[model samples]
Target: MASNISYKCPTCGAEIFWSAEKGCFDCIYCGDTFTLEQMKEAGAVVDQPIDEQKVEHAEEIVDGEYTQTTDGTVSKDLVKYSCSHCGAEIITDRSTAATICVYCGNAVIMSEQIIADFAPDYVIPFKVQKNKVMEAFKEFSKKPLTPKDFDCDKVVDKMQGVYIPFWLYSGKCDGRIEGEGINKKTYRRGDYEITEKRIHDIMRDGTVNFEMVPVDGSAKTEDAAMDSIEPYDFKDLVKFTPAYLSGFLAERFDEDADKCFPRAQERIENTTRSELEDSAAYDELDIKSYQKKTTIEKTEYAMLPTWLLYTTYKEEKFFFAMNGQTGKFIGNLPISKVKLVLYSLLGGIGGTVVGALLGMILG
Candidate 1:
């Protein structure tokens, strides 16, 4: 049977969760904070490895039938674990690493999912607290053309801190670019115009070494949205510990490293080609041929922090995401047709009044 784990305050016996503001686990009831080393010393952080034989046996039994509850049949992909705090049954898909129990609102970490080969090598814990994220989101939704009926408070209430899984790739790229550089000159001599044109063959070649090129490991996350929140500062990364996942929701990698390598490769190749082209330094460069090769040196699995929310306006869903480390927010807001028309009418009226005043002055 899969087991659930929740960090508990040693003094108050209440559930403790990671606090972004405090940079440690905090007890809401006792107003106490505990660091990673303190928790480990208290015996609160213990590894619970799943037994492979039992897991294989359970898989065989639940193969086709899944597990039928008294109420109804559950999907084969979904697994159920009892929440340690509330004893309420928590059901989640294979990709879910941690979640909050709906009944009691206590954080629950599925121990078996994040142990052994599935564990992440590094984690960037949430640095921006929920209140900070809320403030930033309010500023983001302050566009004049936004729909008045859209409730920012409601979306803010639904915001969740998630540790998104990513694959970090490091490699070296070598490439060459061959192009034609053209120069043109024009002058007037003795009342006669003369034009000169020169073309020269240019070739540039170089190598670029890159580290920590990130590609998200969740299929549900949009590639474009993930790309927009680029350039996470990898210097802040800490060794992965379950203590860091105490409060926030986390997802295991559904798409493995092999599946995500192509994206990293594409990014590296494009960067290498651009570097070579820049080195050529021509007024006008037309590329005739480009060739490159990438060799991956290292690949690591990591969990990065993000604040995410979803809301629907006029039946169209909108997604908001923020970089938990840097607080960079990104999302699309709905435009109010009424406001648009009003602004257009006001502008037209003002323009006509200005034109009439100019005509009177000229007459």
Candidate 2:
């Protein structure tokens, strides 16, 4: 991973940007001070995944389903950190540990609780590094209606590398669901009566082999914005490596895999149901009942990538997100009120003048 990514502060909730000039992290909150080296010493640990020791791995997993390895070689776990100064949390893949709080700007080492809660399955290296992210931010601020003093430069300092947690679920699907449907028809006779029929049918009995259904794992992420930056480049996913996480910041799932899995299952079921319904077509959809129950086996966890930013105008915050792998931009944008009013008023006055002139000419 490239060096110099963003991080969050623990004491206060401000997003802290990394500054090359400062060299050391400058916390805007609580005025705590620490360097990357100091934070690293406090917050770094790595444990390799050991498949042979299932019991040990199980013990390590504090909250969710333990990700077991059959290889006998245990996957290593790292000591992730949340900024004591700013309260921002992160997981690092590589050994170099110290980090500045992106929010409060204090130095922080990894915490044991953060390590356990945010353990992730894999990571996507920063292909579009922190600098690139800063560049993107600058471009974004240049758009119309952005604050007059909105110095993209200042945002750069606030830009920290964030590894938002996501759960990627994949497994064989055998779905079954039950729902009632009604079909009504009328006969155009003197004794005509509306005939209504209740229909039921089995939705699926066959297996559906699915891959990479993703669910958000971080409460910090906005649901709508996260969803908009979808369709990651799964092909670019590399084998799990902490080196990929070096110089950047990341989060392990606060939401456990088991809890998060339900969301994935829901998405898969919905997609599968739609597919089945499509096969039944509207004209041929003579149904009495619909039952679909999906059994998901052998689910695997992967981390999909996202680049996100939050901006505020007139106290109203706006979020923007990009698919880190695919570079698909998705988010809500606000129109400039001043510009809108200017145009509206100009059009109104111009129309009134023209109407009066035409009336006089016609008379």
Candidate 3:
């Protein structure tokens, strides 16, 4: 059975959401806040073990087209749950773990999906708030080449904080690099320049250990967009709790840890090779042969904080993302052809005037 969970203010029984600024859950209706410990003490949070049978059943159901329910027929791709706060129906796709009820405007966590095998092992709470993200987007859109008709405020309104699922990989790498080192010496003797070259074979072997290399586990997110806003501070990583997901959108991993490990392996191998090559001290090095072997020691599932916005300009879609923890923002803004032409003409005229003035002065 599908179940929905929502946190309520103890005083007024209104919906409460996690506040990034206060590091606690706040009730807008009652203006009261509660910490995770307080919520637990109040019997608001409880730990549930993974239900392996439910996980298998969910997998079977999603593999079909539709499912028959007591109310009506629902698509297997989407799951329907009733909002615990208002009894309104909440519809979500299979990947969605947390979302807001459209009718009642209450945060709903899909208890079954998250408590199954898809539960995260760790999570980084949001540090940057929506207002800060809006300010950052405003600054980002101020680039001179951006499209004139683009509306920053509209996109800001749609901005949402999400806990992106990631697979953290830890491993050790053993690698060896063989190359030729070249040295060149040039000297002037009696009005004649003499040059001498020396070349020598060099080899280096080393082992490198890496921890917490992240690869996004959701296929819906662009790989490049996720890669751009990286380097999350793992020190802030805490044990996963459903309370951290309140007031935000979250997705369960569609791509399992095994499927995402290859990317992490490649990154680890490339870094190991670079480290080995750097240890070979040489003026000019030409790598002739290289070999590497990587062994994955551990893998962990975690949810990292991110703010995402999607908009379309001239019928082309654009995406922007910010690191909720570090405030690192990245996106490709649309470049206006009209502005490019105007700037080019201005630059050409300015260059011509400067060249003429410099020519006269030198003459």
- Which structure among the candidates has the greatest TM-score? 3
Tens digit per residue, CA lDDT, model 2, 228-257: 667666665655533334344455555667
The root-mean-square deviation over C-alpha atoms between each candidate and the true structure, in angstroms, is 8.1, 14.9, 7.7
In angstroms, the error of model 3 at 58 is: 8.1
Q: How many backbone clashes does candidate 2 have?
A: 56
Identify the runs in model 2 with alpha carbons over 4 angstroms from their true place. 1-118, 147-149, 175-205, 281-288, 344-363
Clashes of each: 0, 56, 0
Q: What local distance difference test score does each model get?
A: 0.76, 0.49, 0.76
Query: Order of candidates by TM-score, top first?
Result: 3, 1, 2
Candidate 3, residues 208-234, lDDT tens digits: the string is: 999989999987787777887888999
Angstrom error at residue 142, model 3:
2.1
TM-score of each: 0.84, 0.56, 0.85
